[model samples]
Target: MPLLSADQLTIQRGDRALLRDFDLRLAAGELLHLRGANGIGKTSLLETLAGLRRPAAGQCRLADEAAGLHWLGHRNGLNLQLSAIDNLRFWCGINGASPAGIDAALAGVELPARARRRACRSLSAGQKRRSALARLLLQPRPVWLLDEPLDGLDAGGLALFAALTQAHLAQGGAVLMTSHQTLPAPLAARELIL
Candidate 1:
């Protein structure tokens, strides 16, 4: 079964209707890559699917009973004043996820111990991006909604994201993402143009 589906979806911003009558699905072990020009509602589509925004015309559905989902927006959703560890801990407390994976997730993103201890505002762009990506690992959601997920990554960060996403797919999870960069060589993705 498909992990997520959208039918007759319409997205708008203020007076502009950016997309209309769009339909898409993301199945388990698959990735749907959203593509469009700037200001073309890619992020809006993702937000609607992630339940952060309301679609103008249609609805989004999840086949899973648990509503398992992770949303990574274009912004690195981290607390600038908080340390990486602290931000992750906050996410854990809110999501009822165990803190055990915090360290491992940080390591998986190649965030050094020193970087983890510093406030997010002090970290480099790549580090901040990795910190946000770590949230995916901190919680085991079955579906991921990612917007501009590759914005600030270095080669290593990109590699880590590809590996982690592939692992998620292998485990029967699904992804819906927007990226301007090409995905890593081994990860296959279906393109959805706006």
Candidate 2:
């Protein structure tokens, strides 16, 4: 059975149709890459799948009993005042996941040393993005809805993120990420352009 499916999905923002008759089906361990020009409703689709935005018409179904989802948007979604670890802990706790093991999560993104320190209000754009990604990992969701997840990462960071995503998929997790950069060579993914 498909892990998740969106049937005839439609979304609108103030009478502007962001997406119309959009359909998607995700199987276990599947990754669907969304590629589209700006203003094409990729983010709107992700938001709808994540249950953060209601679709104007359509139905989304989660097949698995233990199903859950995570969403990362264009914004880093981080608090400037909290340290990376603290921010991760907050998200994990709210999501019913482990809150105290964020050090390892930060390490996965090559930000271990920055874990204890407050999110640099003065940090570079890349560091802030990494901090937000660290929080994403701390939550244990089976589905990931990522919008431009590769933005701001350097070469090595990009490789690390790809590897992490691959590992996630290998473990029966599904990913729906939007990216301008090409995916890693071996993930067996498909891109759907809106």
Candidate 3:
């Protein structure tokens, strides 16, 4: 069975159809990239796959079912009032993941020294984005549903993110992401334009 699968998926928002007859499968270590024009429901699709939103039709099956997935939305899911470390802790707690290796996770995103610093209210846009990504490292999940993760990242940050993705895949994790920016090297991702 696929690590994650959505079969004949359909979703609607009020009178509008967001997705129709959509299907997807992610095997272990595979990465699927989703692309579409603005307002085409790419974010909505990811949300449904992550179980944050319900689909009007179709079935979603999590092969491991017990090991949950992580959903990173366009909003970055950061708290402006909390420190970067605190933010990581909060997401870990929510996901039932312990804070072990949290510092290393922050370091992986190049935020080691500033891990204890206040959040995005004082951080530059790129820093805020990196802090948000740090959650992926600290949290333990088998699948990732990332929406526009590369949005505000600089060239250097993008390079770091590419490496991070490679590492995640190497660990046999599955990823589904939507990005306007082409993913950096070592991803070997397949595209599905909504």
Which has the greatest lDDT? 1
Candidate 2: tens digits of C-alpha lDDT, residues 1-194: 77789999999988999988988898878889899898888888888888889999998887764757778898888877887777777778777888666787787788748445866575666777788878657766778889988788887778777788888888888888898788766666887987
> Which candidate do you rate higher for TM-score, 2 or 3?
3
Top model by TM-score, which number? 1
lDDT of each: 0.90, 0.80, 0.85
lDDT of 1 by residue, 1-194 (tens): 68999899988898788878988888999999888898888888888888888988998999985857999988888999999999999999998999999999999888999999899999988899999999998878899999888888888888888999999999999999998889886889999887
For residues 106-155, what per-residue lDDT tens digits would candidate 3 score against the true structure?
78899648545765678877888888888887766789989888988888
Ranking by TM-score: 1, 3, 2
Pairs clashing in candidate 2?
A: none
CA error at residue 162 for candidate 2, angstroms: 0.9
* Per-prediction TM-score: 0.96, 0.91, 0.94
Weakest 10 consecutive residues, lDDT, candidate 2?
Answer: 114-123
